[model samples]
Target chain A: MGNAFKEESTELAKKTAPADLMIVAKGLTKKYDDFTAVDGIDFQVKRGESFGLLGPNGAGKSTTMKMIGATSLRTGGELTILGKDPNKQGPEIRAHLGVVPQTDNHDNDLKAWENLYIYGRYFGLGRKFLKKKVEELLDFAQLQDKRDVKVDQLSGGMKRRLTIARGLVNEPEILMLDEPTTGLDPQARHILWDRLFRLKEEGVTLVITTHYMDEAEQLCDRLIVMDKGKIMAEGAPADLIKKYSSKEVLEVRFGSSKNAEAAEKLKHLGDRIETLPDRILFYAEDGEKVLKQIHKLGFEPATSLVRRSSLEDVFLRLTGRTLVE
Target chain B: MSLINASIDSAIAIAERRSGKFGAEFYAGRTNAILERAFLAFKTSSWMIVLSGFVEPVFYLLSFGFGLGALIGGVTDGAGNSVSYAAYIAPALLATSAMNGAIYDSTWNVFFKMHFGKLYQTMLATSLGTLDVALGEIGWALLRGLAYAMGFMVIMAPLGLIPSWWGILAIPGAVLVAFGFASIGMGITSYLKNFQQMNWVNFFMLPMFLFSGTFYPLSIYPDWLRMIIEALPLWQAIQLERDLTLGTVGWSTLAHVAYFAVMIVGGLYFTTKRLSALFLR
Candidate 1:
């Protein structure tokens, strides 16, 4: 029976590229009691691809990531990681996956190197292998100087970096990062992004969940934007922007009281207009032309600027709400 | 196949059946890794925490066994042999030492690791299963029990408290005692919601320690109360260890071992179930 099953799986793998598809989910769902955290959702991730789940808090991005990471069981779905069911083969699947959770959970009593070393041990890695792996990862995280220092003494950014390094100790085939840069300063975020970019260059499959659109655009090869436990859109960053947003955006502010009124008068000036409490945004192929038309309409804004479209606009367009709020 | 290979295969088959009965995601059979992590963490932890478990019973031995035993004089052991109050209470203190070590690690330590440390979350994210976690943690607690047992035996043997060659068996007896308490304590800890709820473990423990014939004989109590005290795990542990050290081994000693064996199995079952429910879901 085992032999027959193995043959059948081999035949199935032959139909695909065998290793090309790293994760596949069809009608994935997660419900906690009466509340559904993730409605039925479907997506596929290819090998070596940097995939993103972009959504605001409680949008089921983390839920979906957990299912893919094999730490959570889906309520209803056909979800597979590396051609194995997560619910049945969670430990086997997790053996090849690195997970960097939202918060840093280091063994604070242990040294930074010991943290990496012990995490490697959890994967059943040999002491000899982890010895070199720990040193290499410490260097990768740029924490060689803090190797012997206790994790509790490390700075916030350093702690985060050590956590990331600890996750990579297994040299996982897929690295799942849940909001990897949530509480970091800009410099720390940039450093982390650079490290992640280097890993991507090394052909490690990256799965990231972030509300930061800039991080999504910079890291993700393709992504799914989620809202209210459902996927709003899925595409490459540029493709998604092009499909759902205009080429450029014109920002005009006429004071908080006048912003809504100004948006009504300037509605015909651009392809679309979204009025916020403090400012009005005009989406048009040519932002400069929209600004000029707004001036011709005899309503001069206190402040005006023209810039290119971004994933933030696409998210706002799909969800009807800003990412941070 | 060779006998060894055949037995090994059957063992694996049994394990597979157990995993299937529970859930396949729950066992990777790599509990040693979890033990390694504990030791690595322990290297830097304050030794005073461990010393406290060993010291509590010794202090109890010095105060109640030496100071109070002076007034109480001799007491009748389980085997109907009249023994000194010091020798009589020493074995019970050893059993309490084992219980203290096991309970400390499985309850308070496990609680901290579960809530604040997020250690289990970190471990679960890896390939390790809930069974690996349950067994590994309980095993560590058992080791603490073993350490305290050995330390107390060293004190007991030299003070001429241990009266028989069978007293050496108490080391392994301590392991069994520790394993039972560790498993049940870990299982019960999973149901606790907060630090305030954790105090309930200690609340039950203090009375059980005092009344389980640790410092005196259970015959002092009425028949119903004596039976109630006998049913408690601490009494079982005290009975087993005292029998081993005092040369009072009997059929009831086997009953005490059986009691803890049941606790070990039940505790493991509940602990694994709770771990998967809390984390995997």
Candidate 2:
């Protein structure tokens, strides 16, 4: 025990290393009345790592994010963000964390610039510093021309960018994004991803929750697959796929669910199979090999496509469903 | 533990224990943001401010004091003194005006911001807390009430409705009463889910304004109703203002002031707590 204690103390002394863990949650839970929004779940995020909670709409991703952001209280267990308890040290913890909620919620009463300035002031930033930062953030968000425009007039994408910029005004060490690209167009999503990549390059720890498997594949270094308020699997994107899924996926689409059942009859050719409303998926070590076996089975799917197994396949293997709505 | 580890552990413990401050500061900052936004709204819609603050009060003074006072003649108050109906009702109007302004700002403005505007949710992301938001909103309500009171007092002074320099004290008194109502109204707004229940607030306020000795004296009511009227904070404020304006100041005036002071403090405490719970979550 003394040797273990000595080792732990030695590890604790090296905490100044920039990549130390920034968030720690141990059996954190959130209950609203009798319904459990977030069941007791544990996770840790290291500094500079882009972590994701990948799940469907009702999988409690947002609830968990809210707990870490200090916007919502935990019903049981413990959570610490930036080495501070969210319940007691919320302000101090929040001071070092930026959060972009699922909705816009921008100040419609103030000009876009004023909204940034006022929010900066709330974080105890000086007026002079905020003025300069506001200008820079406006330019960063590409809203320099719309600084004087009311938030009510800005487009959804512009509002989202402004919200992101507002979160960054305090120069937070950890940024929590709750479905950052949920309602954005493809162009807007790409723009937002580019900006997020920049933040990651700056060594900012990011915690994002999204149901988009493509987004998880593109952005997350490590992710947790959640379903029904529980973590189904967790690891680096590639690692999780290697662990729970095959190397490739073969998609076979037919006329309807009944036709998809006929395709499922050929499931023995692959490691696993998934049947959807309008399509069927075969998970196997090699997609081309699986397709050859399907051809030999005399099952002619309306359309068949071979692709690399992704986080989507991992989600399906774990939850028996697709991530998309 | 080593000294450095001990210090770091202490810091973490302190940070954890002090988390509530973030919620508090975020709310306070939200309130300040709302005040700033209200000022911006005032700048853009200057006409609304003028109409609500100046024109409306002046219109009430002229129509009631000059128009309605003529037919009603002088009436006796609870003090057993005869005064012009305008004089009796002017102070009451002043009290009610403050109540109206504060309640309007706190309820309608706060409800809209809480629900439709989603302003508090935006502010919560920052360091501002719920109490900060409540206080900042009440502060603005008080400011609007003060402005209206100043305009009302100016009109009252010129018409000789105010009998003594002591009447000027009613301005701050009006603001205090306004703040009490505003803070309590904010507390009430937290529980209200939609605009439908707001009509209930109007239903309660309209009767309170009319029957709280604003247009007449409470003494005209039977003993039981009169007792209930006296128990109300607005009635106490109106009585205090009327006595001060009429130069009939007495020990009962202190009790009236105490009533509003208690209301201000108590209302603010609960409002801040409720708002913190509502927005912080």
Candidate 3:
């Protein structure tokens, strides 16, 4: 009977086999008591792809990452990782996946190197392998100088870098990072991006969740923009911007007093105008032409500039709210 | 038949490699990994914290041995033989010390690792499962209990409190008692919502320490009250230590072992069940 069942599963695997698909989820949902965190959503991630889940704080990006990380069980969905069902084979699937959670969960009392060493031990790696790996990881994280420092004593960015380095102790097939640079300074963010970019160049599959649109654009090969537990759009950053927003955005600011009134006067100047408290944005294929046309309409802005569109513009257009919370 | 055997052998090999199938060595290796982490942490901590376990019980030994022993000359044993008050309370103190050491290690240490340290979260991210975590933590608690029990035994032997060479057997007995309490204590610690609710730990522990035949014989209490005390698992630990130190091995020893065996099983069940609920959900 077991052999027959195994044969049936192998048949199913052959049928559903994607192009080196690393993760696949369909109708994925997570409900907590009466509240649903991740509503039914569908997506696939190919091998070696850097995939991003972009959303605000409660938009279920983290929830989806947890499912793909094989840590949290999905409430309702068909989710598979490396061709193993996440529900039945969590430990098996997790063997090849490395997860850096949103919060750094380092063993605070241990030294940075010790943290990496112990985490490697959990994968049942040999001591001889770990010694060389720890040195390499410390150098990779640029934490060689701080290897002896206790984890809690490191700066926020150093802690994050160490956490990322610790995740690589297993030399995993895929690395999942949730908000990898959320609390970092600009310099720290750039350093981490460099580190992550290097990891990608090594052909490690990445699954990242981020509210920072630029981080999404910088790290993700393709992304899904989520709002209220549902995916609003999914595409490459540039493709998403082109599909949802225009080529450029014209930002025109009036005095705070006339900002609301200025938006009304500027309504017909572009394809769409979104008015904020202090500025009005004109979404148009040619932002310079829109600015010129606004001047012809006897509407002079205190200051104005034309800039190319971004993923942020696309998110704002779809969600009717800002991405960062 | 050879073809079938070859296919079956290949299938088992695939299953073992793919599943990271845990044998005895797998569990021992992973749990030792966790203890190795503890060892790393201990290297950085002050020696005072490590010594504090031995110090507290020794203080109780001196204060009670001299103060209360002077006040009450001697007391009757469980089998109705008169023994010095110092000797009477010494064996029971080992039990209570074991309880205290295991309780603190399992509850406070485990909770801190769970919520504050996020250590278990990081461990779970690896190939380790809920059972690995439970056993690993219990294993650490046993190490701590062993150290404290051995330290107390060192003090007890020098004071002429041991009535028999069989009293030497109490070292392992104290560790067994510690294992029971540590497992059960970890089970309760898993349910705690926050640190402030830790008063409940003290609440459960203080009464058990006092009433579990630790300070006095159960015969002094009414039969109904004695029955209730007997139901508590700590009382069995005290009985085991008391019998072992006095060299009075009897059939009831198995009953004491059974009490703790039930606790070990039950506590491990709850520890894994509750932790899986908290973490894997």
Candidate 4:
């Protein structure tokens, strides 16, 4: 199935030489009165790739998403979705793109199936085609039994799944999701991730925006880290981690009063060290070796932990702040 | 099922073709699809609300048209002809019913959908444009206005309030009033921010209904006051319906029709502009 989907994409790609580039933006900017929400940024998304925008709240991730979604016009710069200008050809561009917004906006008055069915009708799909498509999407979202239920009766995860299904009713070429898993429980988040991963495998291009570093690492093939409406770094998760962070990290807590004093003593042991209110962080090639060196220097910590470097460390190194507050 | 599919398919093809000719940014020509969604939602809507809209004008007809008209014998219409007090007010009530139905859907229902339901946000995210959304919603409200007008006429015909067969034309006249009110009401709703602001719609509507020559002819008032009431949209609607049902069609009837024509065009223009400003910006 994956090969078949890829082959279809290749056939489509032959129609235009640079057609594989699904989205392109240059010096993109958005402004609301005096506030510049999205300061000039540049990025490109290719066909069949999972691209992401990673940032903290109010970092202009959603603002950028809205511009690409063609609902919000950019205040400056150029954007082309599927080789069509969003400002002039929004309906044409939107017809071929699927959007799953941050918050679920399903019609509470409509039943689960009707939500999907009515959405397809908005795309000018015939009732017969939608009748069959709605069933297929219900099965895919794993909400077959809940088809007749009102939207309010469904659980949070169920509603999210249904929203995702409704976005697919038009069989769009690119699917854009804004904060897809922000409010879900751990298990629910995992299930939603699995579903998204399957779409990626089936060769559907995905554009996602998220504040969660773990989610960005799990889902994005390549991502741009944004801070205060600017791109801090852009790369694959592991490459970003390797370039901006050490191989491992050692975390030690010595109560609030003693942490600052301990960080002063352990500064020379690791490649770098940071002191917080109640803990200290040691960036090193090997965490265990760093711990042993700390002990040899006659520093006994109250509590200690060692872990591998992740995208969080990369974000910290780039922006001098964490991805999530 | 296949036959339904075929017809829908042709309808979509027509809309797409129209969109291509007109440019695809502001209008996709898919207003009918929006109307279809409303019908689907209406299947589950509470019937009491709809029945109540139809019942309000009937009660007014009973109390003011019958009960009060018995005390007051005859009233002078615009044509210098004396009409029964009940017959004079019956056409005005029909005009008021159309306005009420249109206002209810476009203001309260549209306000909820805009702020609470986030419905227009969802629709605009699709291939649908702001014009399509505006037209579809106003079209639905106009349909309800049509329903209310027809229901009131059914009650009026049995009571001998409709004296001439020309009264059938009043149904279309009521629809025009609805189109005018519904379009402008939806546009005004986009500017409102809260339920408190929305109450002002009702506040303004009550005075217009009472003073628009509904209970009596405008000549009873002083000249300046009569001019103010005549300038209102409901008064023009009442004038049009009165001319038709009273068999008094003349040059002034054309003037009344022209007033609503301006309303329909101006309202649709304002509605489309406001919807785009609010959602597509």
Write model 2 residue lDDT over B207-278, tens digit each, in one string.
887788888766579999999988987788798888788878888988888888888888888987786688
DockQ of predictions, in order shown: 0.36, 0.30, 0.37, 0.42
Question: What TM-score results for chain B in every one of the models?
Answer: 0.91, 0.85, 0.89, 0.93
lDDT of 2 by residue, A1-325 (tens): 4345435433543452234878878888999999998898988899889999999989999999888888888999877765556675456667777889999888776789988887776665656766777888898799999999998999999999999998887777788999999999999999999989988988888999998888998999999999988888999999998998888888888778565568547757788888888888888888988888778877777899999888888888888888886
Q: For residues A82-114, what per-residue lDDT tens digits would candidate 4 score against the true structure?
A: 666677667777877788999999998899999
Ranking by DockQ: 4, 3, 1, 2
For candidate 3, the iRMS in Å is 9.2
Clashing pairs in 3: none
Model 3 global lDDT (CA atoms, 0 to 1)? 0.83
Better model by lDDT: candidate 2 vs candidate 4? 4
- Model 4: per-residue lDDT, tens digit, B1-281? 11122233442343345433454677887898899989989999999999999999889888998899999989987768888989999899889889989999999999999998999989988888888998999999888888888888888888888888889999999999899999899999999999999999999999999999899877789999988888999999998898888888899889999998999899988998898888777
Model 4 segments beyond 4 Å from truth?
A1-17, B1-20
User: TM-score for each prediction?
Assistant: 0.94, 0.91, 0.94, 0.94
lDDT of 2: 0.80
lDDT of 1: 0.86
DockQ score, prediction 4: 0.42
Give lDDT: candidate 3, residue A310: 87
TM-score of 1: 0.94
lDDT of 1 by residue, B1-281 (tens): 11011222222232233333345568877799899888888877888987888888889889988899899999987668899899998988888888878888899999999989989999999878899999999998887788888998999899899999999999999999999999888888888889999999889999999889988887778899998888899999998999999989889989989999999999999999999888898
